[model samples]
Target: MALLPTTAQAAQTHPDPRPLTGQEIIHDPTVARLKSGGYVAYSTGGIIGARLSADGRHWDDAGNAFAEPPAWWYEYNDKADPWAPDLSYRDGRYWLYYAVSSWGSNHSAIGVATSPSGRPGTWTDHGKVFSSERTDSWNAIDPAIVRADGRLWMSFGSYWTGIRMVELDPVTGKTVPGAAVHHLATRPDAPYAVEGPYIVKHGRHYYLFASYDACCSGVNSTYKIKVGRSASATGPYVDSAGTPMLNGGGDLVLEGHGRFIGTGGQSVFRDKGKDWLAYHYYDAEDDGTPKLGLNRLSWTKDGWPKVS
Candidate 1:
């Protein structure tokens, strides 16, 4: 892939591009374009770090969502550093789904919180929605949600068993009882390290985007984004080459290039009449400080998503 830049973005001469200048730095972030005509992103850190952008190009630190760490977080992660939050506006309230866990441990949990206004320190933690233990085959950390056909579904996982999905109750934002768990994608080889799955439907297909390889190790990070698609929300997703995602199939959507190392943990949203891919990348030159990454998406005539 040529890694085309968005038409409206300022042109830069790097072979592997970096986001435009200004106050931009984040990791495992999700963007929400507020009705106020600004962008708000929640990333991993203190109650999940927040930043606001008046123009979506320049940002300033907002604050964390929680005034203090929630009581239950210590059971999952004492650091209270919530990870990978998926933010969305639901039922007139802002819904935030975040993960809690210590490093390299399957003892993790995914929690939910709601706020009338989607601003930092305004969230009311609702507590754990799902969790997993070391004995479990899947590590339940990174979380992403999508509303499909009036049903809510969560896609999450990390090392140990790859990505998995469970249907959510739209009203309560919890798992639907008796819902079948779907094991969607995994890398079979050693270092089996696929995580962070986000789903979006365009046309008739539900596209599954997941981060592949390791993350969180700064410049040594090997993370990249890959994708597959299915006709149904409960997927049997296959890559462009027609291999089932269950068998390790995923076509590359974006990867590390030049000074931008470990580009992954992506979220997609349509705003201002254009589709965009929001993610994070390590700045190799900045001693691997994770920074926000945004790239507009343009679909091919045949319906495949390509980074613009």
Candidate 2:
């Protein structure tokens, strides 16, 4: 019998022509559309870096933005695992809140860093803003700060509980003492896995968006984005069908697609008067490793957002 070509031989003879780029491995992307008409993004396990893009597609690496970890962060014995960063402009400064902790544990904290411009080498560490103590029932990670209705609010939590919102003093950017923390949403029945809370205000409503289920671990990931809305920033948020987010009330927004499993540590921004969604998805081209993904967001006539 004639010798037959093996799968390995075939692959070696005609390798995949598509080449992987720097963006392919970039995970936990947080995007900010700069005032200078470009976009800046930060990610995890890479350089503590930023990337600039004129068109929001093709990017040039700006290199390490704030390479030195804060001294307090190391002293607290927190893991160096940085995840779910949120970037925003406030008071003529760029503020970043990033979560640091070991995987699936309450030993986590959110640290602050600031820059006068949204570029590399300008960030100044502001130390830890929030952390979960051993006595607290909820796990704290995924800190997203939003300025709404003349106040600042930080939304954070994960599988041990759900998304919770606490008020922050606008000038100080720290939690206001005795300000009642609200349970904005939970998934007590559906495996109770929720985290990565990102919020946006559209017209008269405040939209609370978050991811549910496991991220990481490649093909075994069950990550998907879910959403709810409220008229007030301190929300009694509800889904479209009138279910309260506090009792596991969220409508499905985006979910996985085959190898492109949609994990949501998402951020929303407006660019040139159009809305955009920025999140990370497993790239099929790169053997299902996570990569940054962006898409336009369209509001339905009835006032719900859809990824376009």
Q: Which stretches of candidate 1 lie over 4 Å from their true place?
A: 1-18
Error of 2 at 292 (Å): 0.9
Per-model lDDT? 0.88, 0.76
On lDDT, the leading prediction is 1
TM-score of each: 0.93, 0.88
Give the Å error, residue 109, model 1. Answer: 0.5
Residues 1-308 of candidate 1: C-alpha lDDT, one tens digit per residue: 79978779663332353355666778998998987678889999777999988888888998888888898999987777789999988899999999999998999999999998888888998888888999888888889999899889999988777999999998889888887778999887855789999999999999999999988899999999999999997899999899988888998888888888999989997888888898899999999999988888878898888886
Best TM-score among the predictions, by candidate number: 1
- For candidate 2, the lDDT comes to 0.76
Instruction: Quote the positional error of residue 25 for candidate 1 in Å.
Output: 1.8
Shift in Å, residue 162, candidate 2: 1.0
Stretches of model 2 off by over 4 angstroms after superposition: 1-22, 75-79
Model 2 poorest ten-residue lDDT run: 11-20
* Residue pairs of candidate 2 with colliding backbone atoms: none
TM-score of 2: 0.88
